[model samples]
Target: MGKLLSVNLAVPEPNPAKSVGRTGINKRPVDGPVPVRAPGPKHGGLGSGLVGDQIFDVQSHGGDDQAVYAYAREDYDWWQAELGRELPGGLFGENITTVGVDVNGAAIGERWRIGPDVVLQATFGRIPCATFQYKMAEPHWVKRFTQAARPGTYLRIVEPGEIRAGDEVTVVQQPKVRVTIAEGFRALMLEPALLPRLLEVEELPEEDLAEIRKRIARSTRQRD
Candidate 1:
């Protein structure tokens, strides 16, 4: 069990890294309960699960599977020390900042009950992108982040409701799957050998599953 440290919403700004020319990665903390729900699919759907938040990159971000993004305060502390700078909540474009939570260690399909009503299920870890590198303004940030393997988890809204800062996060249900958010990220981005283990977690998005299957098939063909 952990506590919600803050509810951050994107403050759109010019994005030279993306062709869209604008990005919602500059998120700032807001003071109140925010409504949350599934934003449908990625492309042509509501971008963010939290009302007042924004997601400019529709093609690669935002959807039912990634409705809300959460990062742990512990991880932020580590990054701050590593980078020798201040790293705030939502700086990584996460909607929720959590304290005392192992976001990466959470199993896929694990359900978290935030505050009183909002139920969110862990889906996958966020993959670093160009926008993140631009936002961080760090050298080889993408590679550094990927190698650290503390990528935060993205969750789907299972039961829509309001969430606010200071809310307690309770793990209502944890699936019997071996694939955790960290393992999923490593499998998808770092180690292809781990892809076969992802199949045991049935809650993975279809696109991810398809990629896993394709990679497995390719590996098999090469072995033959």
Candidate 2:
């Protein structure tokens, strides 16, 4: 169990005209704030540029938190390379910062009960794009970030409860599956053939089931 230190949220400081898609739009500082949106269930719900229930998608969440993927001090080096500069703050653009938890170890469809209000699910992994390279000003930033940090896991709002800073995140449901956030990310970025494993977890909520199922079907056809 990791101690949830802070849960920060803002309206996204400088909004972009268009969405970044796979890559992130704004290249915020390692500790700087970025924009967030409320994506419908269509675009993984919590993908980048989204907040609240949306921050839960690893592929969808953006900013510095993505640098660590999980809030850990060990991820400092990876984010520095991505920014091409020193990190002023330990973490940035992360709604929930915590200590002690191998975020990447959790299964893809794993669910975590943080406090009483929030339920976080390790849905998917993030795939870097040109936007990430551009933001870091390094052509090799994405590769470095992925190799070293593997980013972190995303959390969905299962029950839709209020989450505040300094909350204690407890593992209410840890999936038995061996699939991890990094594995899920690679599956999406490379083969797109493994997403079905998550849908079968049986821990996902009904509201999120159909949307995740739809993504899996699309990916399966692409691979086929």
Candidate 3:
């Protein structure tokens, strides 16, 4: 049931037409992380919120499987009707898509052991933002995504390996916490205070925990 179908990449080039004021390509490259330029931000040029991996993007979040099986084709169609355009394919800009995997239902902190080397962590859910709307050419895309609230997901590369299409993806750990992706999304929006507590649990993998901790501290100081 868990098979890797394909891998894609989108290296950001200077796109001057974006309305959100971001200068990056939507998607490019056939494999590997988007080639980010330096002399930008310390975290490269990745945008905040619904842009970079730690927040809104993923290690590898999309492909044919998700586009066909996981994504809400009807919702996308509705979006097309509402805005007269197609929504972006898959969530998190994943390179490799998985077949027979319910990406949305996969618990937070769940690890998928793909082959001997590559392991992906379902670290968090993607939080849409203004740039998403700009790319979609729809102003209310963020609200629409939030309302639907079942948008795919974000993943982290736990172990680096040569990954190709058609490799079986196996779930290594299903997180115990009852925190749904929707809950995480809502909490991130309404009550960011809960993030620390959620991240403090030992159940979260080390890298995922570290990311949550960084976000918690960053948000805390922003308020103070």
Candidate 4:
């Protein structure tokens, strides 16, 4: 069983250069259990963000597919070594920092039972944006992050409940075929060769689902 290292809350601040004047990508560690629930669909435009956390732009975030973001401490260590800087938990804008859990290895549609009642399903991988690039103060960060391909897992709340630091997280369910979060990122965002592999997973993100279908259709036409 993997452990929840820390529960981080975002603090929105002003930055004139960013896509949004207010930014919530700077997350800080917090104590105690925080409420976890679905924020509804993007079309509905309804969500509470995190309990004490916040988001500047809801259009690209805060929906069902990207409800809860999680990252492994091991990945943080990798960045720390590469960048030669201090990276605390939540530095990457992830709400939950995990230890001993392979966040990238988690399959799409996999369910994790957090605490007692809180359950979260892996939906997609985080795609870094210009807001994130500005936050990091690294101009090449978006390219670097995308090339690294260890994008954190974005989760949807399966069963609403409370989650706190030191809680045990166990994989309650995983898909049969290996459509891991990492593979999903590579296929959907970077490499077209991986497109066919992504189709094997049924519960993948809707955006990727539609794109793959289009790609298949285009290929079939060429074959004809």
Candidate 5:
């Protein structure tokens, strides 16, 4: 269990001059409770987010599996040290900032009951993208982020409600098969050998699971 330090919302502003793309990567912290719910099923899919939070890349960023992105304060502290600068709660574009809980270590399907009615289940890890690199203005940021292997976890909304800072984040459910966010990140990004392990967690993103299954099937065919 950990404390929810802040709730942030996506800032979708058009920067036509820059190549950052139409992105909602710039997120700012907000006060008090914010409504959380699934966006919608058709088209891109419903994002688990604050009422006003705008998701720019609906097709890739927001959906049932990646409804909410969470990052740990501890990891932020580490980033501050690495960057030699202050890294704020919403700096990584996470919807939820957590304290005392290992966001990366949270197992897939792990459910956190946030606030009174909001329940979010861990599903996948945040994959670095070009937009993020452009926003950070760090060369090789995408590669660096992937190599560092500390990607924060993406969670799906299980129950809708109002969530606020200071809410007690209680791990109400942990699935029998645990595939940690870190493990899933590595398997998806760096290590093909670990792909088979991802299947252990059924709640992972469907596309990712399908991709891994396809790779595993191919490998099996080659062996045959």
Candidate 6:
């Protein structure tokens, strides 16, 4: 069991990294409970699972699979020590900032019951983008973040409801899959050799599975 430290919402900001010239990466902790529900698919969907939150880049961000983003406070502490700066709770664009939760270690398809009603299932790990780098304003931030391999987890709303700060998070179900968020991130971004391992987790989005299969096929042909 873990605790929800804060429920953050996007504070839209202008950015050149995105085609829209704006981004919702600037997230801040909000007071009171926020409604959460599935935002359907990407692109023409609702954008964000949280009511007040926004996602400017619909093509690349937000959807049913990535309805909610969560990062562990422990990881923030680590980054703060490494960067020697104050890393806030929602600085990583996560909707939820959690304490005592192994967000990176969570297995794909793992379901968590949050507070009293909301149920969220881990889908994938966040991949760093130019928008994130621009927000950080640090040279090689994408590379550094990728190398660190603590990319946090993106979850889909299983049972929609309201969530607020200080809510309790309980892992109600954990799949038998061995692939974890950290392993998935490393495989998809850093090392191609581990890509095959991701296939064992059926809960991954269809598009992602297709990409993994395509990459595996390409690698096999090259080997032959």
Q: Which ten residues in a row have the lowest lDDT in candidate 4?
A: 41-50
lDDT of 3 at 194: 74
Q: What is the lDDT of residue 185 in candidate 5?
A: 88
Q: What TM-score would every model get versus the actual structure?
A: 0.97, 0.59, 0.59, 0.91, 0.91, 0.98
The 10-residue segment of model 1 with minimum total lDDT is 171-180
Model 5 per-residue lDDT tens digits across residues 1-224: 69899999877766452454577778899998898887664255655456877776656677777778899999989877877888888878898899988899999899999877999999888998767777777778889889988899988888999998899999999988888899888987898789888887868777778988998898789999
What stretches of model 3 exceed 4 Å from their correct place? 11-25, 28-92, 190-224
lDDT of 1: 0.93
The superposed Cα distance between candidate 1 and the true structure at residue 132, in angstroms, equals: 0.5
lDDT per residue for candidate 2 within 9-65, as digits (tens), equals: 433322232253322232222232223333335333344322432232244444322
Give the TM-score (vs. native) of candidate 2.
0.59
Residue-level lDDT tens digits of model 4 in 108-172: 99999988888898988999988878878875999999999999999988789889999999999
Instruction: Give candidate 1 misplaced runs (Cα > 4 Å).
Output: none
The lDDT for every candidate, in the order shown, is 0.93, 0.51, 0.50, 0.85, 0.83, 0.94
Residue 101's lDDT within candidate 3 is 66
Provide the lowest-lDDT 10-residue window in model 3: 60-69
| Two-way TM-score contest, 4 vs 6, winner | 6
RMSD of 6: 0.9
Between candidates 2 and 6, name the one with more favorable lDDT: 6
Superposition error at 31 for model 4 (Å): 1.0
Clashes of 5: 2
Off by over 4 Å in 5: 15-20, 42-48, 218-224
Instruction: For residue 191, give model 3's deviation from the true position in Å.
Output: 7.7
In candidate 2, how many Å is residue 23 off?
11
Candidates, ranked, lDDT = 6, 1, 4, 5, 2, 3
Better of 2 and 5 by lDDT: 5
